[model samples]
Target: MSDSNTTHFTNPSTFILLGIPGLETAYAWISIPFCCTYTISVLGNFTILFIVKRETSLHKPMYYFLCMLAITDLVLSTSTLPKTLSIFWFNSREIDFSACLTQMFFIHCFLAIESGIFVAMALDRYVAICHPLRHSTILTNSVVAKIGLAVLLRSGMLTLPFIYIGSRWPYCTTNIIPHTHCEYIAVVRLACGDIRISSYYGLFAVFFVTGLDVFFISVSYTQILRAVFRLPTKDARLKTFGTCGSHLFAILAFYIPALFSFLTQRFGQNVSLHFRILIGNVYLLVPPMLNPIIYGVKTRQIRDRLLQLFSRKWA
Candidate 1:
């Protein structure tokens, strides 16, 4: 029977993405919003990169981290959005096995790197607000570059194992993934082999990367808050808090939906498939869209630079 099973089942070379299960009829309608979201994300992040690069006044650790973040967001969204739109618009849902794994790697890798950038941004805030005198020395360009390199190396190393594990799995079962993008667990669950190890490693990676980032960000903000409160004047306190407000909003914009999607994917067994998939897509889409907007509105330097650029263009 085992020999017969082996003879009957072979690994699939490609997998079919179902886009959104149970919402097949609305795929076209859904594609409209997704298309708009991707457009906005691309334009906004590129604007950020452009503004930061052109303005020498914006050359600081904070903006350097912002540049890293902009690049990451671009790659992160690009890794999945085009294919997702293709599936929706052209009914092209088949993804080659190697391509699927590559998609999975970039998606997860940049997500982790984004989390790392948030931590670096939080540390920048903590230093700027709490140790204002030492901020420049502590987070110099050299230090920022080192931190960026470390983030890339860490995310790539941690996520590289997913490719190995994903490739090694024998997929004798159906090659239909229910989600639009090739999410790690969604792809792994299709394997006929036991997936406990993959599942456990995934959970560990999430906790290790996101968990530590969240912890450091929390500590940094706590210290920042303390330093802000200790300022003698209300104006001083407000000024310090203003510096961090954008970072706080960007962090919430990212982690909240991310946490919801993670929870629903893992424990919301009763949740509707379409709802979970939509939330997951939103988690990935909204942050890249919002980060630039939040920073543009809240950070005075960026806002001023944007105004100048627009005014010059109009002139």
Candidate 2:
């Protein structure tokens, strides 16, 4: 542990975070790549949202949930990426306690939102498959609106306590978050105080948001699969699977890294820092880019339309 400091755990004042050994690296070189990732993630997600909003033909419950997801992705990615880029590229990793709390708050809230959004998508698929005739009634405009509102509320209430708990704790001298963002568990782990309460909250967050959401999504898909097997034509079956494939792809891209790192840390598996870094990149960077590609651009009709729109505007 190069950052193995002799600093006391009690009455801590400042933290020294071990950012990716880029203090010696030139800022200009790091900034470029950082900016590029940030730009692409933001632009891609936002473009998806914009096209969904502007195209009235896409006003179904399925795409409505997708638009909400795109909004969540944009918020989730922005909550951490820019700051991470600055830390790596500009060597500006020293985050204030208040700001760290705030960042952690959004990160948690948006992540919860993202998780719920996935559940909502799974439910959408279920209705589309199981109750095709009454799908409109079940997945109505008002219902979808309420579900979106419910997602925000669920996410907000779950994370609000963590924010309050984080604000009250004293941090360890080394403030550097191991991963790029100030996640609740990682952030509180730096605290020198009695972390029993913090750890409990972290566990609660894990079970409440990630674990619960994934559970429901799995349940939703089980029902969806049963319904899928009963579809009349092979073409109908293929189309339904196509709708779900995008969401599942995005979910795997986001969760795989998170699960890997969390398990490695909790189980005391001697994971390498380099390996952790790669996992962190997969968690943060890949989903934001690939999500748009899967749900938006790869949907041939949407891609062709967007390209035509762009060509018309440029010409």
Candidate 3:
């Protein structure tokens, strides 16, 4: 029989995901936190979706954007967490070539979706704060629906090239991916051929998509702060700040680690391999786990609704 580990095809038959190199001995212990985070991510995002759908009072652009965000987090976390847990809990790390590419595609797609949703949310905040009178007229239900579709299409189209180019690469040897998930950069690094194209494109996509979103988010917040400060009373300023606190926290939670991971991988060559891998995993895990909590706690409406939900259950 042919050696199961060796493959004759242009593409390797399977890729082994190395979940946290030098930490295999502690996978059992490490799985505890990962499982807890995954549980919270699923339950929290779904609760946001449920509450938003059930509460017709939340049928507005801001809430709609929150719904989009919740959905993206749900998909993004689910895309990788299950497999990651399998590796940690059961040592099932072998992923087929096509499956690996598919996972990478969805991961990138939803990541871009989340970033686009953040931009939409920023724009929603801008309109609500800066152009209060026109906010309703501009971001009507139909308009919000159109924006949702546009976000999906834009993410899908832009991320297509990532997987397309990745699929064509000649991954002849060293199929072990030294990370918990099939990250774009990690997987590409395993390719036997020249990886200049994949590397450059990944960088371009990161900056073009995430950098643009961060820039717009910054501009939106600047305008929002100006508007808030101009309010006549301290109470008015506090109220405006309160309304935006959740989104600001969400942005920081997602981007800070993401940027750190990217920069460390690209420039921090002296950084330990395990540290880079850990940061990458944290970048993927943190946002999904924290976004719902941030919104639920910071937004009074969501917090009140959640309280009412549990109160009813208890009663």
Clashing pairs in 3: none
Where does candidate 1 stray beyond 4 Å?
1-11
Per-prediction tally of clashes: 0, 4, 0
**Best model number under lDDT:** 1
Tell how far residue 154 is off in model 2, in angstroms: 1.1
Per-model TM-score, in order, reads: 0.94, 0.85, 0.94
How many collisions between residues are there in candidate 3? 0
Ranked by TM-score from best down, the candidates are 1, 3, 2
Q: Please provide, for model 2 over 1-315, each residue's C-alpha lDDT reduced to its tens digit, 9 standing for 90 to 100.
A: 344574544433433444544333654564566567667878888887788788888788888887888788777777777777776666676776667778778877877787888889888877777777899988889999999999999889988988888777766556677656666776777777688887776667766677888888899888887787788999988887777777687888777777776556455447666466546545666677777888788776669769978999999
Pull out the clashing pairs in model 2: 15-173, 15-175, 16-174, 17-176
Worst 10 residues of 2 by lDDT: 8-17
RMSD of 1: 2.1
- Measured with C-alpha atoms, the lDDT of residue 272 in candidate 1 is 95
Which runs of model 2 end up more than 4 angstroms from their true locations?
1-16, 21-36, 172-176
Write model 1 residue lDDT over 1-315, tens digit each, in one string.
475444412456789999998888898999999988889989988998999999999999989998888889889889998999998889999999889999999989999999999999989988988888999989999999999999999999999999999988887647889999998878888787679999899889998998899999999999999988999999988887876777788898898888888778888989999999998899788898888887655678998999998999999
lDDT of each: 0.88, 0.74, 0.86
lDDT of candidate 1 vs native?
A: 0.88
